[model samples]
Every structure is written in structure tokens, then in C-alpha cells.
Target: MIPSSLRARFTIIAACAITVALVLAGFMLTLIFDGNIRARAVAEVGDDLRTLAANARIGPDGRLVIDGDLSDPRFRTPYGGYYWQAGRDQQIDLKSRSLLDFTIDWRPQPPTGNDVAIYERPAPEGRRMFVLERRVVVSRGGTPTIARIVVGLDQGELDEARTAFIQFAASSLAALGFALVAALWFATSASLAPLRALRAALMEVHLGRKTSVEGRFPDEVKPLVDDLNALLQARNADLVTARARAGDLAHGLKTPLAVLTSTARQLREAGQAEAAADIEGEVQRMSRHVTRELVRARAGVRAFRRSHPTPIAPVAATLTRALSALPSPRPIAFETRIPAEAAAPMDETDLTEVMGNVVDNARKWARGKVLITATEAAGAIHIAVEDDGPGLPGDALSYEIERGRRLDEQVEGSGFGLAIVKDLVEAYGGDLTLTRSPLGGLKVDIVLP
Candidate 1:
């Protein structure tokens, strides 16, 4: 597909319009010049014919004769592309030597008082001739005899002149079109510089390098930049307020839950053992819910808005040590195959929260061994957590990773670990998938950009 960028579209449209305009202008110019040259040729031939008619006389033998010299020398050269002829009573009388036996072949028509008639006629060697013809009356002894006089000039020179004009015009117009396209390209790039700057600012905002759009812009784009900055400011302020409220709510509930625990202890001491157990279970469930909400609050809008490069290897190593220290009935081996240079593109706190939950869950389910490995490729980080326990069935893989979905409720878990990891990964333009592991257990693969 052709990229739908503004520059490409504008260049195509402007180039088409300019090419069409130049072609039409060149065609019209050539046409007008050809017409004017043809008109001038007819007028010159008419003038020469008038001069020839004025020099004619009726000789005593009733034949036509010329009085004196016609100024043009081509009248004497045979086939010189110029000629003259005269006739009386449909019989040829006098003619120019240049005709060389090639007849003008013009039919004379009587003209109004001083008007001349001109037409194109055939001449020698297949050349075209512009002929001017007229009928004249000569008187002898007060009696008049009508005679026809004609003059012609070859049209080859005019055709050559028109061809040369067309060639020159075509070259000039092509040069002009090229220059116009070049100027348009330069002007278009310069005009869109502000937009390019705006795009760069947006990229920086996405990468958490800048808080808002910044820099000078044209009047046309300044308002847009202002609106985007306003949106970012509002978003950041709202996230801060929401997180503060969540923190306050969690602290408030913690105090009440602690008092409840103290009361349950007193009941157990007073011999109401069953009631104390039930109360403690309810309180623990409530506490877990509160902790889940706190995690959600931490993974707030700012989780994605404020990004910082966090090294994955160090965080994974720290998590490995913490998980290994936990007491388990079976000795569990923890393996960390992460490079020191591996980094994820997200805030450090968010990455810690997300990876912690995932690694802890793997430790809980793995029977003999758990593996945490991370690698960097293409502009993204890939982290996988695998375990050697009974993996989930293929039929349950799609929905089992969702929140509050535990295959066995007998297991002590709220089932929010994978869900939280998925949510946090997507928030930072990443994805998480669950699949069967080579270690005969579940594999959690995450890609963070």
C-alpha cells in the first residue's frame, strides 16, 4: 500500500496540476503563433498581387504587358517558390519566369472595389502555395477587357518556422515544469517542519522522556499542542489524586481489620474456638481483597505514563533470592538465566510489582524446580517463568489465567497473580501469554516494549 502521508499526497496532486497546466499553455502558445504566421503570409501575398495588377497594361495586340520592374528578384528565378501569372478571356497571357511551366491553378473571382481574395493552391514539386488572385478591367478607346492576375509564395518557410517554435516551446515548458516541481518539494517540506516537530514531541511523551508537548509552533498548530499538554496535565493530576485516595482507604481498613483480629484472639481464649476460626477466615479473606486493591492502585494510569528503563536481571535475581528463602515441604530449586544487560521499558516500581507476583506464583505451584529467564531482542524484553509441576490443560489455558479463576479453590490463592501481570504488561504496551512449559508445567511468557 502507498503510504498516506501528507507530503506524498500533496506532491502527487501538485505535480499533476502543474503538468496539465504547462501542457495546455504550451499547446495554446504554439497554436496562436502558427495562426498569426499564416495570416501574415496571406496579407503579404495580397499586397504583392496588388502591386502586380497596378503595373499591368493592355498592349495593342490585345495582350497583357507589365509597365516596369517588380522589386523582388525571385520573380526571375525558376521554381524559386514565388511566381505570378495573368490571363485574359480564359487564355494565359503574361507570367513570371520562376513558374517554369508550373501553373498556379487558381480560379479567379471578381472582387469588390479594393478587396483582394486569397487561397491556398498547389504549386511545383508538390509544394503548397498561398495565392492571391483578382480580376482587373483595362480600357482601350473607352472599351474595357477583363483580365485575371495571380501571385503566390511557397508556404514551406512558414511551416518550418512553426515547427521550430513548437520544439523550443516544448523544451522551455519541460524545464519550467521541472523547476516548479522542485520548488514545490522544497516549500512543502519547509511548511511541514512544525508537524514533524509535533510528532517528535509525541514520541518523547510516549517514552516518558518529556511530560508534555513543548517547543515553538506555527499559529495553525499551536492550539493543538496546547490541547494535548492540557490533557496530559489533567491525566497526571487525576492519577496522583486517585493513588492518594486508595492509600488512605487501605490504611483505614487495615486498622479495623487489626482490631477484628484482636477480638478473634480473645474469643479463642474464652473457649469459643469454632467462632474464632470462622471470624479469622473472614478477616483473612477481607485482608486479601484489600491487598489486591492496593496492587491495583499501584498499577494506576501513571504506571504507563511515567516510564523508566528498569534492568530485568537484577530485579529477577533479587526476586529469586526472596522466593528461595521461603520454607517449603519439598526442596525447590530456583534457576535464574537472565543477562545483566536485559532491561524492560517501564517504570521500575511497576516492573517490580508485576514480576514479583508472577515469580511468587511460580514458586507456589512448582513441585521440584522453577526457572526465571529474561532476554532482550529487537527493542523489547522477553521474560519467561517456567515450572516443573502439573500444567494446566489446553482447554483451560484461555480462561484459567483470568482474575478470580482458580482451577482448585482448595489451593490458597486469590487467583489475581496472572491477571495483574497481564494488565500491567498491556498497560506498558506489552503482552503476556500462558502455555505448557518444557518442564512439564505452566510457562508465563511476557514481552515488554
Candidate 2:
């Protein structure tokens, strides 16, 4: 299949154009050189015919005769492919010794505007000849004799010259065409270099290595790079604005909620304890929703905007210490197993939020022990928080994790913890899995790249 690529198309076009132009040029040069060689051969033979005709004499024997000194020795050598002949009245003739008893098929033409005719004909021994012929009048003392003088030369030398020229010209032109096409390839690659660099920059942005494309670019592509950078800038600005709005809205509702909390406490002291407690419970639920909304906004922005490595050991240690100090009816042991340098590819804020929620949930349900372990595998970091408690029914494990579906409504909190952790984990391009723990309870595992 032909590749749908810019480089391939350009190379094919250049090769075709160079090949066609060189082929035509080579043929034209060969023709011109061949014509000149043949014309010179014909002209030299014409001179020989003229000299032979001028020296011819009608002797007392009444036979055509010629005695002349031709410069070329081939004229006197038999079958030398150079010859001269003279004939009259369709009878006997005089000819060069090179004829070797073979008569030229001679024909006479009436006097015309042109005195000489030049053409080609086949010769003895399968050789081709270039012929130049003229009609001449030889007058010795009185009567005139009309004679045809023809001179011929073998075309072998001209053919050899033409073949040699064609070979040299073809080879030279082929080499020249190759060099030019190679130069065109280098020029094309140099011109397209900027495009390759631009692609690398874009990939870096996508991988969260950089936020924008950088470096100088050619005029043709500069506008596209500028527009892409501008778009990233605008997106970041919009995220900042949105996050500020969420923070403001969450804080704005807190004051009214505080007033309601105060009023509910007063109602409890005024002999309406049951109704007051219900009001406090609803208030707490609303507060959890508001807090989770803030977390959601922060997770969304961090996931889309940027990424960095977050160390797992320190964050896990901090959460373990905080949860360990929390008051409980029974002593709860918090154990951490993490590699000191292990890190996950995620924002620090996101990693903290997710791990905090998972570890906090384990503390609530754990009977006496909560274990947090972190490890690296398959180019990702995995953090598992396991707890020992009365485990959920097999079918209820997934159901209880749904937002607001607490295993026990009698428990004193809204049920958005696991759901929020799920959201934050997904935002960081990671996953959260819940399964039966080896500790005889639930295991919340987080995998992040």
C-alpha cells in the first residue's frame, strides 16, 4: 500500500519529475550528436565525389574513365567501404578499386535546382552506407559526356560514435539526477524538522510533563503553537475561577449552618430533645454534602490541570497517627507498612484526600486493628487499607458503598466517605477496589500510576 505520508508523497513526486526530465534531455542530446556526426560524414564524401568527377575523361576508347588522388587510402583498398563510381548512357562505368567487381545500383536524375543528393543505403557484408551523389558534365576538347559520380562511406564509425556518446550521456545524466534528488530529500527533511519538534512538545503536555508548548517555531507553524498555548492558559484560568467559586459557596453556607446548630442546641435544653436531635442529624448530613462538594471540585481541577509525584510513606504515616489518637470506646491499633521512597503519579492534594477517607473509614469499622500497606508493582503504586471487623454480607459489600447507603443508619455519620474516595481515585487515573480482606474484614485497595 502507498503510505499516506507527506515525506513519501514528496519523494515520489521528486523522483518522477527528475527521471522524466533526464530521460527526455538524454534522448535529445544523443539525437543532436548523431545528426552532426552523420552530416560531417556526408560532407566529406561529397568532396570525394567532386574530385572524382572533375578528373574524369572520355578517352579514345570511348569509355568512361577517372584518375584522381583521393586523400583516404580506403578508396583504393578493395571492400574498404569507401568508393566512387561514374557511369553514362546506361552502359559501362568507372569505379574505385574498393568496389571489388560489385556494381552500385546506380540511377541518374535529370538536372534540378539542387545538384547533389545525399541519402543512406545498405552496402555489402551487411554494412550500412552514407551516400552522396551528383551529376557532372566532363568535356575534353569537344564532345560532352554526362556522368553520375557517387561517393559512399560505411556508417559503422558513425554508429560507434553515436553509441559511445549515448552511453556517456546517459550515465552522466543519471548521476546528475540522483544527486539533485538527494539534495531535494535533505531540503525537505530540514524544512519539516520543526513539525517533528512540535509533535514532541504536544506529547509532553499530554503526559503532564509540561503545561504548554515551548521554543521557537517557523512562520508557517508558529500560529498553531501560539493558539495551543493560549488555550491551555485559558483552561487553567477557568479552573482557578471555578475552584474559588466552590470554596466561596461552601464557606458562605457554613455560617447559616452554624446558626442552625446553635438553635438546635437551645431546643434540646427547652424540652424538645427528640426534634432537636433530628435537626442536628440533618444539619450534619448537609455539612457532609457541602464538604464532599468542595472535595469534588478540587479533585476535578487537579486531575485536569496538572500532576506530580506524591510520596506514599509520609502521607500514610500522618493519617495513621491522626486516626490513632481519635477517641474510641476500645483501643484501636493503627499499623503502617510502606516503602519510604514509594510515590504515586498524582497530585499531593488528591492523594491525601483519597487515602485520608479510606483510612478514616477503616478506623470507624475496625474492631481493634487497622493496617495500611503500600507497594509498587507494574509501574504503579498500590495502597491497601485493611480492617478487622464484622464484615458485610457478600451481596451488601458493593451496595453499602453507594452514596448515602450506610450499613447501619444507626451509625452517626453520612455515608459519602467511600464514594468520595472512589471519585478522587478515578480523577487521578487510578482505581479503588473493595474485597474481603485477609484480616477478616474489608480491604480498600487503591492503584495509581
Candidate 3:
């Protein structure tokens, strides 16, 4: 599988380029070595041809002959790899013993006066040969003639050396390519280190550990850092402005609402019962809307961004104690089974409000016992409140708790409290659930992370 990381992609590209470079370099180097080796072989053959020329002459019988023994011993060895021949008018007059009557495959061609002609022979005896030939004037015993002299050498030694060189070059290049690819991987890693650091800094900012992303970054990454910081500042400013506006709206409308309440009361005392009823109903509706908006405004996610963790045990105990004091037809017992370390990641006030509403709701319906238990696990807080009273049916569990709407008018509660709790829990990145309790009553479960 291809890696999704930028570093891996860069390494792959670099490896391909290195492989291509190695292939081209190997081809060029092999060509250069072959040319040099062939040139040296040609020079050696030319020297041998010159030696044969200096020693050759036309004998008294008009036949080509040598004045003395050849310097190279291979010239006398039968069927040896080295051989030479001398002839006039395409007729052989003298030859090396190495030929063994297996004549040189010489092709006739016009020649330059002094320049030697050298070329590779076609395959013979399942091996290649290099031939150097020249037409030269020689005289001995008062006889002169133009003789064609040719020297040939087997190419097996040069072929073996070239093969060995190719093997060595291929292995060396393979090792080099590996090293270069590895170096590229490390280089890419080092270059991306700054990006890793920047990501960590952003995480810290998100967790509220720091207000803005901070730390040293590469020049190429500083612009992003600066932009993030500016965004954070702008967000904080917007939150402040929004909070002030909510507060202002609440304060600005307080006097008018108070006056309306006062006028309704006055009308009620003056026998305008229908008018008072209408005014009171409108006022109540306005009051519910204002209260819901206030709760929502305070529970904004950004508003609680810097909130400290609030322990749940103390809050549970306090609410239990306060609720136990209320008079009832039967004495109710409250059990708070929360650990000291169980804390919710929200403000103390908001946590108190959320737990208070849930606990109170449970207390109202509990027959004789209310159980409160909370735990902290894996950076999350889970709270369960169970009551022993008659719980709602499965269909009733979907209680659409909205502002100014009560599920049952017989119940002496606004029903908006749980709605506020739900909003508050969600604002802090948490969730609330209603389920059948093991205690045979309703269970309110909340998890906050």
C-alpha cells in the first residue's frame, strides 16, 4: 500500500530518480570501458603487424618469407588464440603456425598507404576475434613486393573482463541506490519535524492548556501560526461581545417586564379579570423565552472554554442534603456513591445546575430511595441517577422537554430544567440519556469528556 504521508511520497520520488541516474551512469560507464578496451586491443595488434612487416621479405623463389623468428611465442603455437598472415595479390606466402591451416577470413579492401585497418571479425569457432591488417612494401634478398599482413586475437579475455566490470558496477550501484533512498527518507523526516511540532501546539491550544498556539516554528510555518493566533483572538473577542450583548439585552428589558407584571396585578385588583389574564399569559411567555435564552447564552461552548474541572461528589452530596430536608408524605433516603476524583469538565455553577436539575427530577418521582453514582474513567465522567419511583414507559422515555412545555400538568414543575441541563451538557461536549434503571425507576445518565 502506498503511504499517505508526504515524507513517504517524497522518498518514493527520490528513489525513482536515483534509480534512473544509476542506470544511465552504468550504461555510459560500460560504453566508455568497452571503447577503451577495444582501442588498447587495436594498438597491440598494430604493434604486432609492424613487427611482422619489419621481418618480412620476398625470398629468392618470389615467395613471402620472414628474415628471423617472430618475437611473440604464440605465433609458433598451433591453433593458438594469436595468429598472423602475410600474402601478395590475395595469395598466402607466409603464415604463423597458430593458424594450423585454418586460414584467416580476410576480406579484400582498398587500404590507405600507411594507416592500419582494424575491425572485429564475424563469429568464428564460437568466439569473436579482433583483426589488424595493412598493405606494406618489404624487400629481402634483392626482392620487393607489396604484401598484406594481418594479425588476429581472440576476444574472450576482453569479454570476460567487461563482464566482471559490469557485475561490479551493477552491485555497487545497487548499494548506492539503497543508501541514497535511505538518506532521502531521513532528510524528509527532518524537514517535516517542524510540522509535527506545530500540530502538537495546536492540540494544546484546543485542550485549553494554552490560549493560543505557541512555540518555535520554521519560517515557512510561522505564517500559519500567526494566522491561528489571530483567529483565536478574534474568536475570544466575538465571545466577549456576544456575552455583553446578552447581558445588555437582559438588563435593558428588565424594567419593561417588571412594569408589565405590575400593570397586570393592578388590573387583577380593579375587576379587569380578562385583560389581566391575557397580560399575565403574555408576560409569562416572555419570561420563559428570556430565561431560556439566558441559560443558552451562559452555556455557550466558548464561554466555558477556560472552565476548570468541578468535582461531582461534593455537589451530589450537597444537592442530596438540600433535597432531603423537603417535607414529604414518606421519609426519603438519598444515597450518594460518587468518588472524590469524579469530576466534570465544566464550571462548578453549570455542573451544579445540571446535576441539581437531574437529581431533583429523580427525587420528585423516587418512592423512598434515590441513588446517585458517578465515576471517572479514561478522561471522561459518567454520572447515573436512579430512582425507585414508578418510571416512565418506553414510549414516554422520549420526553420532548421544551421551554414553557410540561409533559404533565399534574406534576408541580416547569419541565424546562431538564431542557436547560441537556443544552448545558451538550455545550461542554457531553451527552445525556434516559434509560430504565435497575432500581425499577428512571435513570438519568450523563457523560462528559
Candidate 4:
């Protein structure tokens, strides 16, 4: 599933809403504008009809005639795009020359009473007309005569005006949509700027390149950054205390361990070989434990001070080279497989010590072959060292891991190697596991998070 961002979703919804509102408003305005133009045309035609009716007169032969000259320039010229005609018995008597010699195509029937008829009709000049016809009684010498007057105004000019308004409205609406989208883009970017800065700061922290976040952030996000910095500081202080304690503990044991070694050497000189050998072995075990603890303590202090990530591949390769330089008669074959760009959250010195110890232990017990593998998985780094030596005894492996426990009373070295591995792993928030290898030997698996 693709994740959606708040800024993008909000911008899209807002733009759509604005566009819908503008469209609705534009439609309403277009209707109102067209209706107003049509209404005014009808009103003007009605007024012209009234004027024609008022000027109606009856001649001596009972023929209808207009009292005033209908030849007023207002009537002669189509100044307002209006036309009119008045007649009796379906015969034209007077008409506006604004028609340009093209008569208004209207048939006005003699009215039954005093009713007026109003409707729309086609006029000359390819325009529509709003027509109003009325019947009037003209009295000459006390005799009443019926006459008809029809007046019309052209609707084409109104239609043209409405079309222009619609075009302008469409253009305006298009411009508004573009402006809205542009504004939304800028607003979204501004709102998300803080998140971007936070991400950059996090990257710096991850790489150990920066100890603190720096930049001005919005009020809402400042607290979050502050909390992160506080957490990092607390962790660093705790690590410092742990290192000091480990160092102090190691220092306190050195005097007793040195005295024990001296006693074992003197016994050997006095020719009590059997007793001296036993004491020497015990002394060596204590010395190894103390040394391992010191290394583990220092590893903790150095893990956070790395200026750059240590690539595991080159470290493994370097270990292979160093081991190959040892003049061993066992015909040992060293095999290494590591990724091209695999890295771990460890300093170079710490990594060298960790890898060297594991590999050296493997070389000691291996009959003919050793293998080293390094890879990354699940947000952690894994390093495995295997040797074709007699696998560790089950009971002995368990006891050796117990604090200050040794499996072999006669073993020539401190049995604290695996325990040191465990301590270093824990210091880095990682894990170390020992298991039987497929080559009928022991496999050391280290995972660093």
C-alpha cells in the first residue's frame, strides 16, 4: 500500500471544493444575466406598443392614422435595435424605418375586446423580436373604429451580450482554478517544511555525525526534537558510568592476579612441577578474565565516539590476512565471504578486537578449515565464525557462559573469551550466540543492532 501524505491530500480536497463552488456560482450568474437582458427587451417593446396606441386616430373614411409624424429619427434609425409597426384590419399604416425597409413579419388580428396580446416573433436582420399587439378604438365625429398596433424589440443584441458574459465567466473561472492549484502547492510545501528538517536531523544522528539537532522549528515540533536530544544525552551519560565502573572493577583485581602469577612461577622454580602447573593454569584463567573485562569496558566507551561507520567486509578481509601470516603447521584454509558494502555500528578498533578474538579462537581448535561470513539483516549486522574443530561440549558450553565460570581446570588460557563476546554484544545492544556448526565444530554468531 502506498502511503498518502497529509499535505497532498488536503491540497487536493481544498482545490476540488473551490472549483465546485466557482462552477456553481458561474452558472447562477449566467442565468441571471441572460434573464435580465430578455426582460428589458420585453419591457421596451411594451412601452413602444403603448406609444403607438396613444397616437391612433380615425380618418374621415374610417381609416386609422397616427396623429403625430412617426418619422422621428428615434423611430427612423435602429438606435436601440428595436422595431415597431401599427395598422388596421391586418394592413400596415405606420412603421419604423429602423427596420431598414425590412418589415416586421407580424400578423396582428383585430382584437375581440380591449385585450392586448404579447408574444415573441422572428424579425428582419436575422434577429428575434419580443412583440406586443393591442386593439384601440379611434373616435372621429362620434364614430368608433378599431385599430391594431404591434411593437417589437430585437433580441439578438441581448443574446450577444449574454454570450460575451458567458465567455468572460468561463475565462475567469479557468484563471481561478489555476491560481488555486498554485496557491495550494505553496501552502502544502510550507506546512511540510518542518517534517523535512526533522528527517534531515535524524539522518545526521543516525550516522553519528551530529550530537544535537540544530535548526529553528515550529512550536508544535520543537518539543519532540528536544525530547530526542535529551534521550541521547541520558544514554551517553549512562554509558560513561558503566565504562568507569568496568574499569574500576578491572583495576581492583590486577594486584591479586599479579600476586597469584608470581606464586605460581616460584613454585615452578622450586621443582614442584605438578602443583605449579595447576596454579599457573588458574592464574592464567583469572588474568584472561580481567583482561577481557577491561576490553569490554573500553568497547562500551568507544562505540558512541565513532566518526564514521566501519565496513565489515574490509575488517574481515584484514583479519584473514593477519591470520594467514601466522606460521601454523596445521595446513589451515581460511574462507571469507562478505558483502561489498556491509557496515556495522562499531568503531574500527572495537570491530578489529571483536573479529580478531573470534577468528583466533576458531583457528586454535580447527583441524583444517575456518569460515567467516558477514551480512546484514532485519536492521542489524550478523557475523559468523565457524571452525572444523571438535565442537564445544554441551555441558561445558553452558557452564562457561555463567559469570566467572570455567569449563576446563587444565585449560591453558582464560576461559573468558565467549563471556567477553557476550559483554561486548550487550554493550552495543546486540546479541551473541554459540552453536554447533555443520562442519562438526563450534559456530560463533554475533548480531549487532
The parts of candidate 3 lying over 4 Å away from their true place are 1-4, 40-104, 125-130, 149-163, 270-282, 301-304, 308-344, 365-418, 431-449
**Model 2, 127: alpha-carbon shift in Å?**
5.3
Candidate 3 overall lDDT versus native: 0.81
Q: What is the TM-score ranking, best to worst?
A: 1, 3, 2, 4
Per-residue lDDT tens digits for candidate 1, residues 34-147, read 889988877777777878788888889877887775678888888887788888756788888999887777474555565677778988889888888788878877888787
Each model's C-alpha lDDT? Answer: 0.82, 0.81, 0.81, 0.77
Model 2 Cα lDDT, one tens digit per residue, 1-449: 77787777898899999999999999889889988888788778877877887888887788777775798989888888797777885564877778888767665563443388777777767788877877777776788877777788888878888889999998899999999889989888998899989999986775577999987899999999999999989998898899999999998999999999998999999999998999999998898788778888898788776565778888988878887787888888989888888887778877877788777777788899999899999888899999998766777677755543543353455245666777777877888777889899889888986
The per-prediction CA RMSD against the true structure, in angstroms, equals 4.2, 6.4, 4.6, 9.1
> What lDDT is obtained when candidate 4 is compared to the true structure?
0.77
* Shift in Å, residue 143, candidate 1: 7.7
Q: In angstroms, how far off is 317's CA in candidate 3?
A: 4.7
Can you list the residue pairs that collide in candidate 1? none
Better of 1 and 4 by TM-score: 1
The better-scoring model by TM-score among 1 and 3 is 1
| C-alpha TM-scores of all predictions | 0.80, 0.64, 0.77, 0.55
Model 3: pairs clashing at backbone N, Cα or C within 3 Å:
none
Better of 2 and 4 by TM-score: 2
